[model samples]
Target: MSDAPSAPHLSRRVWIMIGAAAAIVTLSMGIRQAFGLFLAPLALDMGIDRQTFGLVVAIQNLLFGLAQPFVGALADRRGAGTIAVAGALIYALGLVVAGLASNALGLGLGLGVLTGAAMSGAAFVVVLGAVGKVVPAHKRTLAFGLVTAGGSLGQFLIVPLAQGLIDAFDWRVTLFVLAALVALVIPLALGVAGKPPAANHTDGPALKPALAEAFAHPSFWMLNFGFFVCGFQLAFVGFHLPAYLRDGGLSPSVGATALALIGLFNIAGSWLWGAWGSKRSKKGLLALLYALRGLSMIVFILVPLSPASALVFAAVSGFLWLGTLPLTNGLVAQIYGLRHLSALAGIVFLSHQVGAFLGAWLAGLTFDATGSYMLMWIVSIALALTAAVANLPIKEAPLVRSALPAE
Candidate 1:
């Protein structure tokens, strides 16, 4: 099998591009992560129920996942910079629309559709695809991990800022402020402005053949299923945990603090996991992450709900959070090559989003019907174990296509 593209040194331009991509993710993901903070206030103010809010967010996740492949394919053909600029503009518009929305229809259009579509371009898949083409093969996973950490940084910083804004003013004001913050991504997008390097541009299978190859591979499907479990567990906790804490007699501040803690610790987790994957078996590390996450969830619910326990849960779960992205994307690039990476990873990501949709919507439905998230927690645990097993069978060696000419 041929080796993927590799850079001999980390140039100044490379670092700058990585920084810009990470910052874009920081802004886009950071703002999106704090949507849970908006739920209680928005639901009460809009005179809607938890299910309504959940469904809106669910639509957002679904659209975010659904648009990724098309958007990623466009990035591969055109350029990540153009897509990112457009995404930032739409992202800002979505936030403003969401802030002004007085009805569910407006919220769905702004938050669900626009923001979802915007994220497909501005966030991980497109940005990482740009990075993968430039970095040395040995360092690519680490670079991906660093970019993944930006999202954690955003969650830690932005979630608190959002909570404070909501407390000082209102959710509407908070949304507007976040919109202004995310607009910064427009300038940063320029760092990753071109198509793939000449080497990749001149070689590799076309989009159709790439898709056909991935679709025929069993490991690709396994990766998708494992990623689905990741989405299910994360979306359930991120969107619903704050409300759960409130039901257990905790204050809103505690909930916000818990989420911030998750983001804070995940900064370390994402970096370390990415670094580890570079040196070890990416699949083994992924399986372990899922298993540990399941164990953490079980212990958190079994123990009495206290501020201390909640914080501990936040720290542990946060450490496990988002560690999946760097490893998963790295696996795809390692096995399939980078020529069509964005589109391939986007398809895998779509499955994750599907799981996220169910996690958010189902938890809300369960809460409305039974007044507890116990059932969803159980489901998350089962899925985690399944993912752990699912990743074990994947072959890490690159797929060798006989028909395509070697690089």
Candidate 2:
């Protein structure tokens, strides 16, 4: 056999590309997470009920999910930078519009549609897709973990910053400031400039046929279904937890602190899961994480409501938050090659957003009807348990092509 170099050095440009991709994820997710802080203030300013605000946020989550698959496909075909830049512009516009909005329609259009569409383009799938292509196979897991951790850091850093801004200035001013910050992501997107050319092969399956193949896989469906529950649990708490705490007689500072803690702790949790997933059975670990999340929710709901309880819940729940992301994305990359990862992961994320829509909307409905969020908490727990069970049986083997003679 001819000998060739076994390992290659990563260039400075590749490191820069990775950093750019991580920053894009950080800014995009940071802005999205900060939206929760605005829920109460936006509703109060527009003279709308909590349900009205909840509905718009629900619409946002749904639209984000709906847009993701298409965005992912486009990013896979085109360069991620093009999509990232466009998404940054739209995200900035959304924040500005939300700041200027005088009615629910404007809020929905700005905060819901524009921001959601922008997020779809700039989300983790697109970033991870680029990173997967550039980073070596051995280092991909660690790279993805670092990028995901950046996002968690953004959430932790931006929320408290947003809260402080709101305290010092008006929420509208805070939004405009955020819009300006989001605009900076455009230049960062430019750093992910180069992408590999598509391989030319006459025997290769068409994109649609390949997608169909993925759809028929039992493991794919299991992952998709389980991710749906993940979205529901996370979105419900992200959007409503602050409001829930207020209803329980806690202060705004307490709510902000709780959110910050979740973000902060998730940084550690996501990295740990990513490292562990690389070494062990990702599916089994994912199942256990989901089960623990369900148990945590049950305990939080069953216990007495107090500031101390809320903080304890936040600390516990934060450890589980976003830990699912690394494993879920890693599985997608493992089963399918990184070549089609963005599109496949986007489809899975779409299911997640559908659950998010239901979770956010139903929480509002339940609260409006009974003036209590206890029932929704119970529903979240049940969904988590279902997700845990669904994940348990997923086959972790990579897809294999049938043996055939080359044409």
Candidate 3:
């Protein structure tokens, strides 16, 4: 609870910081949300099956996850501004390259490696670290929630826009346009310029100590495992749900609209849970979120397939989509302190991405082998339930008490 402001009012600088961070997250995450929309188009163009394209997206997810710790560590030592700018450029470049790519290696290099690395900078970890440094402790959870919502908003708004563009133009043209959108993050990074809160270096003996503490904690591992479910469920659904719907006789637009719904509802989910985390049990809320995910997926499976059923699924699933983010990030700030927020969060995110890789790749492999995503859906449900259990016994209080300077 360091740097909790006495008053409830937020300063102009804090507002600006939040706005810029959110904008960057919007561009970063918004564009990423559109990736699933391209899967079918790309597959048709390349003459590949779901598993082949799934491997590419899986590579992207894995690379994104793999790059986070290093990016977080860099942001901790350097500043988010530099990282954001680099991320923006690299991200833009990746899109341009992918738009022109003729083969799998080209797609993987452009989308999988470069853009994925860029996202670690432009998305949650970097933005939250920067915004968290400028905000008071009491409002930190709310801030994280609001910023997380920005990404959701981007997802909500961008998916439909991407679909529209795809309808009007080639996917190549759509990608180039998205690249232009990503480049906007560069100037915005200036608004977010600052080193990680000094407490990151001073509050603990050093970054190593904070890292050591987090790695050793059993709750940290639990959080990691639980978040893995989050990644798996999201990646599987995000990348494949549209195709799944296609198999069910739904049109591509149906898939686009469904993804958009998830984004729209998630806007509320992230904010509500974020606000709740400030006053409630973050772990408890996370447990509920995952349990609901399991229940919803089961219901979706049991129900008959139709436009109405799909939309309902989207609405409910979207609300649960990112509900875990704020709670998890808030829990990190609560337990570990904000000094190493990006670094620690990055490690947790890597776990999520690993799940993402497995989710995307496994779904593809299963569909290719069994001609259905039934196994993947079952696994997603099981993991969601397991995530609920994984989070139930977690301790959510601040863990680094020794280093805290006495009042």
Candidate 4:
């Protein structure tokens, strides 16, 4: 052959959609991750104890998780744009309320329920679902990686930015500023709405039958259980690590840096998982990652506490942090197909959030009672190891196609 046919090129519209998705993800996650930087400051400002603050965050995680399925459903039915816009507005309001909060109720309503619900609408599930529709199947993993990495970049960039704001002005001002920033997500989300993509099989089997099929799969249960542990470990550390570092006599800057490091390194970690998932068995990689998380936690606990050590722990642990997200989400797409992925992924995510509730709440309860986080640390490691073992047995395969109606 004299010349091979030239490859087709993606239009400007597709690139614009990709950019919008990335921007939405970055803004949403940046605001969500910035909440950790405010935990202690907000608590102290409101004259509440750490446990009280932890409980609010715990509720947020719970509600966030609980709201996912419903939100995903809405997005699937109404389109992702409407859901994203509503979430952005609610998120903005949540920040505003948190800025003026003077009691636990305000915090709970503003930071917990409102923000949680908003996050449900604006989370990775929705963002990645949109990406799945736009990107080619062969390049989907890379697209997913870019979106996940954008969230990590948000965390990396926003934590320090929020901290700097807090330092330069006040926490209240920082909250208001962040609220203003969150409002920007509304426009970005608009790009994701409209017709479902060719790759997206939105009118597939009924939701009930799909759920039934997933429930019958042994690997699905394994993946669900494994995901629960991921939630437990990550939420526990994310919500409480700042407070724990403070307790250990570290400065607020150290805590912020730790969170930033986790975000920074997680950018690499998520990309690594995306690349690896494209090449290897995702389940096996998941198991190895969980094992590494457990090992990292063990080493962190064993070492004497110090800012240097905390940073080191953050850098190492960060690599294993949200790395689980891309793999877990990819597994859902691979196993269930994209037809009902938002709903199925949302359900699995609910379990993860339940674990998050436990992790965040229990850390506070145990710490309040014993004045030590050592036990929580141990539990996290144990859960990670258990997840590693659990994931080892999961079998990943495509779902059996059914002639059932769309739910």
Candidate 5:
């Protein structure tokens, strides 16, 4: 009742905060997504094979997810702004180190360790956590959707720009340019500089009890597993799709266009999914999304590869891309309440990162050993189907402390 009364008068400050958070996501995600473009170039320059490049990227993905919970918890206690500013500086440093790297070790340290850590603080979980606390409950999902869309927007805008930069200059120079771009996050991050108001203090249990409650719940695990599938599918396709296309004799531009198309379409998808989730059953929609992804991938792989088909797949996949974040994050806040939202969401996101590590690394291994990506595609499809079914039995109601076992 108290939270509902002030819903009508959303202040200018709130909108600014939302915009800043979205912009931060734009830079962070935009730069990261374009890394796939550097795969071939990096391999050639470093005298490494596909698996080595993939492994380092996989390490980055793993580190990104692994760091989220601790970063999120720190954000919860210390304020998202502090975490974000520091993350931005580190992000820029990571890119610079990556640009200067002569071998895989340097890449792993820069891309894997530093940038991954930076993203944990500057990207989705931390940003959305800040947004969820400030926005009203009814409007939170939409705001999250809007923020999520920034990532795709970055992909759409930055990926092509990156491709052009790489084409015009060397990949190393392109990376340096990206580092400069990410440094802008430091200023924008300051716009969302404070913790949630005191009203949020009484909304849910403290961090320890909230962690205990979520860990004990069945629905939480269901969401985690479903998200794992999401991570696997996205990482596999995002990292390997370009190489797969090239293997099929498609032009490099086709791959770049496809990635941009995914980004472009996902902007709309994120918005629609976010709005729809406010009215619909999030778990049901998640089931449908996963099923559609599996169907899309199945069709893409089974059919003859072409620029048109690749572009079509990108558009479809893009729409479904980051929509999961808003719904899944919303569910955490909806069921568990806002207190400790970032930490819980971060934990769920860790499962996603683990899947990403396997997806990127395993796909490389399969491709190198077998000379084709068919096996990995089949595995992705199977996991997607599994996720679709796993999400069905999840309970959507808010958790009651009394319903839990004795502490």
Candidate 6:
């Protein structure tokens, strides 16, 4: 189902599809970001320590990463709309399984594997892939940022509500309620239910050649390496921040508020960053973003813990959070072209998820072993700086076909 060459205008249909994609992302990503708020209650109810819970959470992210490329390809071959709808159903099923489960193993099966795979089909990458296909190259990142911001908006809107629900009913019931809420993404997905635009003559060769070319390129590898840090910082912070704040003698409300602030600020940051990236060097911006994360972590750990500090940290961190996504994804499309954008983006995204797995798992193991999160925080800071350095070498230009040797 190649897209029609109809002079590429943002018509009513395009905006409608964009709105639908954004709505779906709002719930999928928002709920994922809210997982940290459940750690204490889930662990308490299940009689598990942070390490065990962390391992399962880590597994969830790991599975999500592993599944995404394949899922993205499926979305590419089939229609993103169908894949997204299927993902929503699976997401609901996964949540239901998690809610009904009483033990760690059962919860792991639900939350770690089922939910993770569901997210592969339903979450950020899938929606971004769809959004990329519809919008023209010039406006792609801006549109991607809109969907990215939708996820942030979801975090801002849902985390507080989830926290209140958890407070009122309990974790299990809250999850069930969320399951129902996620179902709404299904109808919205209908608007995105079609194929990518047809490949123009300038779009290069088919999938295998494009992939081989991407893999052979040094810039792609560099992109993958830097993206790992994004995953690590985000997953570690998202999953552990609430617990960290609680351990510092803050109330639950404070932790919840901090998370909400992150969501709130990211809504603005994602849009502004992508809008700015349209003109500036994306790689430079990425390096700066990573460096800021390191500095922010240092400041966060050095400063005494309090509501003000937590809120301020959330504001700063949130501004930098998830903003990398549109830039990175857009960069891939810029270098590789949109024909294989979904598959290539999925491959790069896997790096982030790998870091996510390590971040969550290691944070938990370190906490249980030493009863402190300091080691993980230090590791995060070092990785942030390293990623900043790594992004410096990326070349953002499109691949030069004539220069390549015969495949």
Clash counts for all predictions:
0, 0, 0, 2, 0, 2
Runs in model 1 deviating more than 4 A are 1-9, 199-203, 403-407
How many clashing residue pairs are found in candidate 6?
Answer: 2
**Cα deviation of 301 in candidate 2 (Å)?**
1.5
lDDT of 1 by residue, 1-407 (tens): 01323333689999998889889998999899999998899877987688888888899999999999999888887879999999999999999999999999999899889998889988999999889878888888888988999999999999999999999999999999999999999889889898766545333587887899899999999999999998888889998999999999999999999999999999888888888878789999999999999899899889999999999999999899999999999999999988888899999999999999999889999999998899999999999988998999999998877666553
Indicate the TM-score of model 2: 0.93
Question: What stretches of model 6 exceed 4 Å from their correct place?
Answer: 1-9, 403-407
Superior candidate under lDDT, 2 versus 4: 2
Computed on alpha carbons, the lDDT of every model, listed in order, comes to 0.90, 0.82, 0.87, 0.81, 0.88, 0.86
Question: By summed lDDT, which 10 consecutive residues of candidate 2 come out lowest?
Answer: 1-10
Output the lDDT of residue 389, model 2. 91
Clashing pairs in 4: 206-405, 206-407
The reply for model 3, stretches above 4 Å from the true place, is 1-8, 200-202, 400-407
Q: Please, what is the TM-score per model?
A: 0.96, 0.93, 0.95, 0.93, 0.95, 0.95
Q: Residue by residue across 93-209, what tens digits does model 5's lDDT show?
A: 999999898888998889888988888988989989988888888878878888899999999999999999999999989989999999999889888898656534445677787
Worst 10 residues of 3 by lDDT: 1-10
lDDT of residue 229 for candidate 6: 89
Query: How far in Å is the alpha carbon of 18 misplaced in model 6?
Result: 1.8
In model 1, which residue pairs have backbone atoms overlapping below 3 Å? none
> How many angstroms is residue 401 displaced in model 6 relative to the true structure, after the best TM-score fit?
1.1
User: Which model, 1 or 5, shows the larger lDDT?
Assistant: 1
Runs off by more than 4 Å, candidate 2: 1-11, 200-204, 403-407
TM-score of 4: 0.93
Ten consecutive residues with minimal summed lDDT in candidate 4? 1-10
